[model samples]
Structures are given as structure tokens and as C-alpha cells.
Target: MNDPSGPDRPPAARPRVRSDLDGLPLFRGRAAQSGMIRLDCNESPLAPPAAVQAALTGAVQGLNRYPDNAAADLTARLAERHGVPPAALSLGPGSVGLCAQLIQIACAAGDEVLIPWRSFEVYPSLAGTAGAVVRRVPLTAGHALDLPAMAAAITDRTRLVFVCSPNNPTGTSVSRADVERFLAAVPPDVLVVLDEAYAEFTGRQADPLDGFALVREQLRQGRTNVVALRTFSKAYGLAGLRIGYCLSAPPVAELLGRVAVPYAVGTLAQRAAAAALECEPEVRERCRHLVEERERVRAALLDSGWDVPVSGANFLWLPAGPAAEPLAAHCREQRILVKAFVGEGVRVTVGTAAENDAFLAAASRFARTEAAAPVRSAALG
Candidate 1:
């Protein structure tokens, strides 16, 4: 008899995966390499406040039990804090996870998800994973989202639109008035997701868009298609814990909850976020310092002849054009890391003053070297 388990037997057919996913671009946030001054990911340079740390310590004792799938206590606390009913909130691993769920609930196959080009990299990936067509509207010449262009691009099949305030990698935002005007032009059936991952850093910016306030206004107006995503990752120093909440109409929030990964928000994350809310003064102070640093860094880059845009976030975008990768490599040589978008630009987070100073030093040196190369080439010619 033939040996059924022998090497001669045909290899078991590989499990099938969605072939469309093969075309999806891998998400690419660099991890902190050893001994590098990491400013690549837009994570808070400071750790969580003492109260939050204590909460995490206490929460560790209950790891044997599954987290509350509904995150009831945390939801109630967040509802009270935001002055929204608990029914209007949905918890997820991060705002990014909520983003995926938003795409899931809104899009069927071939439906469209509109986003600003180069806004958040994950938007396309999430939409594509849900079998939706990704539509990108380009940013304006000044690197801000072109809200009018995005509004014009929407078709009836457009199920969701992501408006990332203080857009990732660019550090530019849409003003409240501009967003309101754009919303007026949007079809009432299309969902608008205001991604406010860096909202705390925008307090000092002139005429900043308050996403939570906008969501509340939409709800009061009986529009159920607008949603706001907030995270504890940035200003609250809970990036590792991965807790975020969505503010939406009660029906939308319920839909998000229905599709969310059960218990994705852990016990420690919930407790830590609750403790973080109690330490609002400390979080505010930290954000204040980061904003100041962000402005200072932008000024320094401008003074050094780099055309840095005015940012409402805790990072600066250096539109390095073709030299983006080389500039990033130069910083790495000095043991500093920044997120580079290849031919597009580089995003450097506002870290502690010393860290910023070191990056500034590296950046200055790279600028001088870059400036000299063309001159030398001209002389050679």
C-alpha cells in the first residue's frame, strides 16, 4: 500500500487567503532601535503620570480574568467626561482600530472610502481590507488637506470620508469653519470620520478644529453620519496600552461595537485611561510643553532656511522632496531616528529639549552639506 504520509504524497494545499490582500502595502512604523534617540513614531516622550502608573500596577493582578468586553466602567467615565451618553461611545484598541471598524460598517464590496492623499497611511489599507475602493484627493500646495477638492471627489458610492486634523506626517490641519463648509457640501448619507489623534497639541493653534465639539453639533442637528475618534495614546501617554474611543450617534456607536474585536480594550488600558482622566492637569501641562517645543523647532528649522509649515501638532514636517531619504539617513548616523516618507518629507516628533537640540544639530549639518553639493557640482561643470 502507498504510504499516505510519505514525502511522495502531494503537499497539503496551502490555506487560501484573500488574494487582494497581496497588493496591500505593509504598515511601516519603525520600532525603536537600541541606543537610538527615537522620534520616529509620534509617541509621547514622557511616561504616563504617577496615578496612571499606579492603576496599571493594580490592574496587573487581574490578568487571569478576561477584560469587560463592553468596558462599561470606562465607557461611563468617558461619557461623563465628554458629556455624551454612554450609548454614544465605542471602545477599541486604538483610534486606528476604530477606523477599520468604521470602514467595515460603512462599506460593502466596491463601495468607496475617500481620504486626503498622504493623510493617514492606514486609511487605504483598512478600506481595501474591507473590499472598498480607496479614493485619494491631493493635498494643497501648502501641504494642507484640500477640503473642497475632497468634497468634489465624492460620488454616491462614497461610504466614508476620513478628515485627519493636523494630518499625520504633514502636521497641518483644517480649520473648523473650513471643515463645516465642507460638511455642508457632503452628502448626508456619507460618513465623515474626524480623526483627532493629536487634538491635545492643537490647543495653542489659532482657530483649531475641535472634533468632539463638531461631533456633538452634528448629533444635536440629528445627523448620524459624523464620528470623532480620540485616543489616549498621544497626550495621555498610553500608546502602549492601546485604548481609544469613538464619539458617534448612538446607532453608529452600536454598529462599531457590534463589529469590534471582543475584549480588544484590556483591563489595564481601561483602568489606566480612567486614571489618566483624573490627572488632566498634568496631561495638559505636558501637552503645553510639547506644543511650545513644536513651535520652537519649527522656528529653528525656518531660521535654518527650511520651509517648515506652521503645525498644530507635536511634530514638524520637513518637505525634503527628493532628499528625504538621505536626510533621514544622516540623522540615523547621528543616532537619531525620524519618520521619513521617502521622496515626500520627514516627520520629526517634538521630544525633550535635549533630544530636539540633538536633532536640530543633525538637521543643520545635513542642510549645509546638501547646500554645498550643488555648488560643487556647478564648479565641476
Candidate 2:
């Protein structure tokens, strides 16, 4: 008999992958390039506070042991900070990770997740990964979430809805009153996830929605569907640590914890995040400065005749339409990186003063060059 392990032996069949994932777009972070000023990923321009850095250094000694699976200490700190019971909070690697858990807990194959188009790109990917049908509600003419349309789009099949305030790419936020009205239209059984990753930067915006406050009220009223997600990556400068938390009704939080990967939030991240909470004053100051920089950059772009929308987040949206890719290309050529959304627009993160100035100069040059050229159709044909 021929040996089964012989070189000419028949190859074994490859393991099967989920057919639904074939067309799914993978999310990739922009790689850092030496000498390139990156204003593409919406990251904090500053370093983490000294206290947080110190905490990380101290945490390194405990690497031989496993992280606290429950994240007890950090959870308690967050509970006190938000004035909520520890039972109502769940910690994950990041708000994005929490988002995936949220989808897992709420959706099964063929269930629907309602999201605004061009808001957070991850929402669709996460929902799709769970085999959930994604219903994209288009943004309004002003590049903002159309709450009325989204409310109408919900059906009995809808399992979850993601409301991204000061939305990711557009930087347009809905008012608290607007969210309250939208909530009234949504069925209580369907989960509404308030993604507030940039909540710390919304202090300067008019009528900003306090997601935690809203969730607290909902919990008090015995409603358990509304959940608030906050991340330490943006204003807290903990992007590298990958720590975030969510506030929801105790039952929802319990579900999230149950579905979370074992020890998802590592010891270093937990310690760093807890230390970050103690440095709230420093975090607030950094956010204040970034918000100011955001406004200044928007003003400059507006003066250059760019249809820049008012931004409440740490970035600005340039609704360049068909010019989006070319504009991003031009900035890239100047050794500056900005995010371009194919036919939609470009999102430029606010950076240090010098870096912002460099980006501004490149943008001005691109504007002048485009002006000197013949006008192209919006279709780019």
C-alpha cells in the first residue's frame, strides 16, 4: 500500500471560510511613515499624561500574571467617574471592540442593524461579520445624520441602531433634543448604541448630547436598550493601549461581558486607563486645545472657499465631492496624510500647530491648482 504521508499523496481539503465574508472589506489603519505628518487617523496629537505613562511603567512588572478578567479596579474607577453602578459598565479592548460585542449580543444571522451612511465605517463591517443585514440610512444634504429618515427605516427585524454623534467622517453631531426625539420613535426592544468616542471634544459644540446622562435616565426609567460607548484613544491619548468602556443597563452590560473575549483588556491598558481617569484635568485641557485647533483649521479651509462644515470633533470634513481623492493625493505628495472617502469627502485630523500649518499650506496650493484648471463635472466623467 502507498504511504499516506508520501509527497505524491493527495492534498487535504482546505478549511471552509464563511461565504458571507468573501466581499467584506477589511479595516486597515494607515501605517506611519517617517517624516510624514499624519492627520488621517483621528488620534490625539499629544502624548498621554505623565501619570498614565508612569502607570504603564509600573504595570509592566505584573506581566507574568494574567490581567483581571473582570477589570474590577478600572471598572470601579469608571463607575465612580460616571456615577453609575459597576454592574452597568463593561470594558473592552476599545470602543470598536465593544461595538463588535454589541453586535454579537444583539444580532443573529439575518437580523438587521440600522446605521447612517458615511458615519462610522466599522459599524457595517462589524454588523456584516455577525451575518446581520446592514440597513444604511443616507445622511441629509447638510452631511449630517437624518434622524427622521433613520427612525422611519427601522423595522421589526432591526436588532440594533448605531448613533455616532459628531459622526466619524463628517464631524456633524446631533443635538440632545434631536436624539431624545429619535429615541421616542425607536422601539424599546431594539438596542440603540450611542457611540461617543469623541465625547470629550464636544464641549464647544452647541447642544451636544451627553450619552452617559441619557443612558442613566433610561436605566432609571427601567429601560435597558440604550448604551453609551466611550474610548480612551481620542482625547485620552491611549490609542496604543486599546482601552475603552461602555455604560448601559445592568442586563446589557452583563450580556456584553459574557460575549467578550477572555481578558480582552490587558493589565497595562487597565492600569493606564485608570490612571487616565485621575488626570481628567489634563485630558480636558488637551481636548480644549484640539477643539480650538479644529476650529482654526476649519476657518482657514472655509476662507479658501472649501465647503467645510462646522465640526464638533477633533477633525474637519471637506465635502469635496469628486475632488476628494485628488485632494488627498495632493496632500500626500506634500508629505501630509489625510483620509479621503472616495466620492464623498476628506477627513483631516487636527494635529500640532506646525503640522496643521504644513497641511494648510498644502491644501491652499491644491485649491489654487484646482481653481486654475477647468471645472470638472460632479460625476468626474
Candidate 3:
């Protein structure tokens, strides 16, 4: 069979990927499309604000020219919002993109990057790509990140730690006190990234813990290693545009900028993000609406006997354990898509009212079907 194309048929052997990558899984999630209620990616179910739409419309005319590589306007607007100097900001294609760049800036081969297990799916693979070894500490019994365990795992090799507050999938946030203690315990040389991609949702909470404020306070107290990550993708409804930025000490922000790809944040994305910021009050109101919907959805699930977490983000986590896949499949059959971790759980983003109602109906059906099924041992007997 090989002889049919001669000795060169196979071409040169493709260069092998790094050995460390052999078993690591890549980031996998559902993409946006028409005619489906996408509750898998934790995206905002709302449309972008009017101002953002207008900005993007105008930005299209500027496509002939290169985007502002520095993204100065967006950065300055974000700086003012976060009460940081413009020099303390760095923009990227997305917060996840910045996560990869941050690893590159702070880590080398054999350096350690620590993150919580069952957190954002991107951290492990991205850190690996940056030549850093990843260490995953398990979440606590309550499904919150085990910050104490993470602090205990830090070694001389540990150069970076990611704290995904209102963590993905599980949707639980770490308390400010806990994070502050964890930061205090860790070596000052190690960078602690407080990823607050879902911070806006927490504002309506009974006792709000602001990740940006936490970072600012720590920096004010002279802890320069802490950084806060945010995005326009969630609350701002700009997931399609892929714009996010980080707030950090000036020196660290400079390093982050160095690793950034030139023109990574396009003109449309930058303008849209800036415009989104201008609609902060409106955005907060949208977040509050989502929060209300989230609580309602969780209550319905709880009433239905499903164990759901208290989500700080605009999603619900159903720890279905071995039944996770079956439940997810059931939802798919009903035309609803949710993110499922095989053998662990399902994460369903809170969608519009009608979408949530449809999902609830499907969930009810699934529960009924499960209840009506015969017990395995009894049936066998």
C-alpha cells in the first residue's frame, strides 16, 4: 500500500507535539449558532447594549485601517472604571487569551502554574502551551475553590496561580477574606490572577465581594503580585467580539503587554468594549435581571429535587455525578444544550425567560422519566 505513492508518499514526518501534551485535553465548548438556546458557554443571553451596537456599526467603516494596537481608548476607559492608571491595563483578544500570555510572561519550562480543578477548562491546556507545568488543586466540598489547598501546594517552582472567582461550570466564588489570606500566605514573587469574568453578577448579591476592589486594596497595601481579570464577554454581551483586559500593578501590566499579539484586540472589539463600559448602569441592570432569573431557575431545580449550587455567576451547576451525561443528553433531545462534565455535573447558563421555561420543562420530563424507571436490582431479581 505504501509503494503506491513511492518513498516520499508519506511526506516528512510531522513534528511531534510536546510529550507533556500527550494526555492533556484541549478546550472544548459549544459555539454560538442560530435556532438553538445555547446554555452551555455561560454567555450573556442578552443582546449587546444599543451603544455597543452603534459603536460596532461605526467601527466597520474603519476596517481598511489597522486597529489601535495599544487599544488606548478602551484601556483608559477601563482604567477609569476600575480606578487604576491607564498604565496598569493590558488588553487582549479575551481574558482567556490573556491567561495564556500571562503564563508565558511569568513562567518558563519547569515553572509551576497552579489552578483549581473543575475551574475554567482553559487554564490547564493554556499553561501547558506556555511551557509551564500545571498543578490542579481540587475544589472544596462546597464546590468552591480550595484556596487553602492551593496555598499549601505552592512551592519555589510555583510562579503563577489562577483564582477563577465565580468559577466556571460550578459557578461558586471565593470570599474576599479567603482570597486575601491566600494572597498573604503565598510568596510575593508568585503572581496570583483573580479571574473575575463574572464579577458583575455578584454586585447584586447580599454581601458583594468585588474582585477588582480586592485587587486594588491589595495593591494599595503594596501587594503587587495580584491581578484582576475581566471581560466584556459575559455581562456586556460581547462574547462574539472577544475582548477582555486585566488590571495589575504597572510593572506587571507592562510585562503582560510585551507578550500580547499586536492588533490582537480589533477596532470593532475595542470600540464595542468601550461603548459597553459607557452603558455601565444599563449593564448592571441587565446583570441584576439575570441574577433574578438565576435564582428563580435554581429554585425551580431545587424544588424538582435536583441538587444545584448557589451560583454567583449567571449559570447553574447540577452535580449529577454519574448521571451527568444522561441528563445532558436528555436536554439535547429536548432542543436545549448544556455543558456536561462526564461523570461529574452539568452547567446550564441562565437564558431568557422563555428559554429557561423550556429547559425547566425538559428537566421536569427527565426527572419524571428517571423516577418511572425500574430499579436495576429489583428488575434483575
TM-scores for all candidates: the values are 0.95, 0.95, 0.93
* Residue pairs clashing, model 1: none
Model 3 TM-score, 2 decimals: 0.93
Candidate 3 residues 1-85, lDDT tens each?
Answer: 5685687576777798688777677665655567778898888888898888998898898899999999988888888877888
lDDT of each: 0.90, 0.90, 0.86
Models, CA RMSD each:
2.9, 2.7, 3.5
List candidate 2 segments past 4 Å from native.
Answer: 1-12, 371-381
Worst 10 residues of 2 by lDDT: 372-381
lDDT of 1 by residue, 1-381 (tens): 658899788888989988888899898666647998988889999989999999899999999999999898989999999999999999999899999999999999999999998888889899999999999999998999999999999998999999999899799999999999999999999999999999999855667799889999899999888999999999999999998989999999989988999889989999999999999999999999999898888888888777788888888998877667888899999999998887788999999999999999999898778533432343245
Flag clash pairs in model 2.
none
Give, for candidate 3, the lowest lDDT window spanning 10 residues: 371-380
- Distance (Å) between predicted and true CA of 66, model 1? 0.7
lDDT, model 1, position 243 = 88
